[model samples]
Target: MDTKKPYLAIILIQSIYAGMFLLSKAAFDGGMNSFVFVFYRQAAATIFLVPLALFVEWKSLPPLSFVTFCKVFLLSLFGITLSLDINGVALVYTSATLGAATTNCLPVITFFLALLLGMEALRLKTSAGIAKLTGILTCMAGVLTLAFFKGPHFKLFCLHHSHTADTAAASSSLTWVKGCFLMLTSVTFWALWLVLQGPVLKSYPSKLLFTALQCFLTSFQSFGIAIALVRDPYEWRLGWNVRLVAVAYCGVVVTGVTYYLQSWVIEKKGPVFLAMSTPLNLVFTMLCSAFLLCEFTSLGSVVGGLLLIIGLYSVLWGKTKEQRLLNEKCVSTGVNKQGTELTVVTT
Candidate 1:
């Protein structure tokens, strides 16, 4: 039962993310301003998390220096603020399915970024290295397929299409291309955040405080971005509607709750294990978008999504194999050293 906890936690986290995609898409479709939505979402997260973080971690919190604060501020600016703002716009132009499918490239992106940052080595002779390379290529192929192709749209169990003929007609190829690139950019920032977070955490080791500070800072940053772009006061108002629900759910559940849950899962099972479950979020989002949102699924999306999933698993497999080999080598070396010490003592 203890062993299964991490798996269960990850599945729950993915389900929550699936809900986020659906609700966010619904909110966007209902004519909510994406920038304002990001602002409100971060604000809500701040409201929910700040008190909790203070209550839990205040006593044991490390001293936050000015440099660390600056790091957190910049991290929040790029990672949470820009990523969410751009992703919200991308969701408006594309289906929620595509948004989820694009996220499957995160592991590959992170790997590539790690290699670029000199945090990881590339050795083509090894099977693990070859697998990682293949995964990167496969993921890129998936992204290209998703961006260019929209083959054979199929409705799944919907009596009527949610989009009107005129509305569907208004969606041009340029918009699709724009949305694809925006989503990719958002994912890239997110992957960078994930990569850089390791060092930031080491410097300021209070995980709860770190997360809360980011949320707090992002609330303000998103607000500035929102107020600048969204001039109308009406766009900032949240009524008793799906938009409000989306904001609350994304802020409280997706941002606040999932962060804690993810930390627990990562601690228990390691990051690679958690990353391997990301496809479940995509699958759940695709199914929910089809059934609830009545969104049409294209064959290209299906094909591209399959490719992304394959690439994700391939990368995860390589990472896992590499870690296993490293552990074995360390164990062998320790055993040899122990034997040598024993022989010296015997002599």
Candidate 2:
């Protein structure tokens, strides 16, 4: 696997997520129920991924075990249900700026979790460790810049529905403390899920099938939640509206494509690597908002984004360098080298 490919995948995924944020904000403004939207998104993702899984992993499909299904179910619950569904609820109660700032916590959360689980080492004395830490913190700073600073409106192109999201922002219902806690809950579980998925993917090793299974499971789970909250069947009705469009876009692009990409990245790079890529979405959001929504491109946002890129690259370079050194050591010591990690010590 080319080292650059995962980075490209993550960057592209981040850009898509940033654009999705704007589009979904518009849909939310148009009075779409978050729960219903989640159900639709999951349903759509299942529809898209199932076929791919069937065709690609058809021959190599691992036999389904109860334990594997259970792991996949837990993944669906945490990754989709808590991360996204609860995240939507948190966004409603919080300001976008606040949400953005806290959402940057994912990398930090995953970093600590991975370290504690022995999946990552904190060799603070090493240059690689220092670079990784710096990059993680730099990404967070970039998020802060995005959250707090909106410079003069220098954007040339603007979306037609930008005003809708603007109106939604204006009419936001903010409960700062409550929103912060809820946002924390969402990101914490999301980060947790990312870390846990590594082991699960190792055991499964069927990326598409696993992703599709998670989406398929989430579709049902979200539907049940929707039924509990929205007793009215009519509320769940789909129409040719922004809500429908948002669901379709989220289902196909956000869930279907990004899930597979994320799984592959996690399987290859580990959780911290995946977490590091998340803050890039904030950078994407700033640029997308400026260009597509005619929002001002703040100097702070630009500087922060540049810093974030530098930091992210620094981390990637550090990890790559560290991996190379580790592999060389393993080979020299007559230990087993399994790509990014040691398979066994033959001493």
Candidate maximizing TM-score: 1
Q: After superposition, how far is residue 317 of candidate 1 from its true place, in Å?
A: 0.9
Question: Candidate 1 lDDT, tens digit per residue, 118-146?
Answer: 99887889999999999999999999889
Put down candidate 2 lDDT per residue, 83-104, tens digits, no spaces.
Answer: 7778777656543433444555
* Stretch of 10 with least lDDT, candidate 2: 168-177
Q: What is the TM-score of each candidate against the true structure?
A: 0.96, 0.73
Q: In angstroms, give how far residue 20 of model 2 lies from its true place.
A: 1.9
Cα lDDT of candidate 1 equals 0.90
> lDDT (0-100) at residue 261 of candidate 2?
83
Stretches off by above 4 angstroms in model 1 are 1-3, 159-161, 164-170
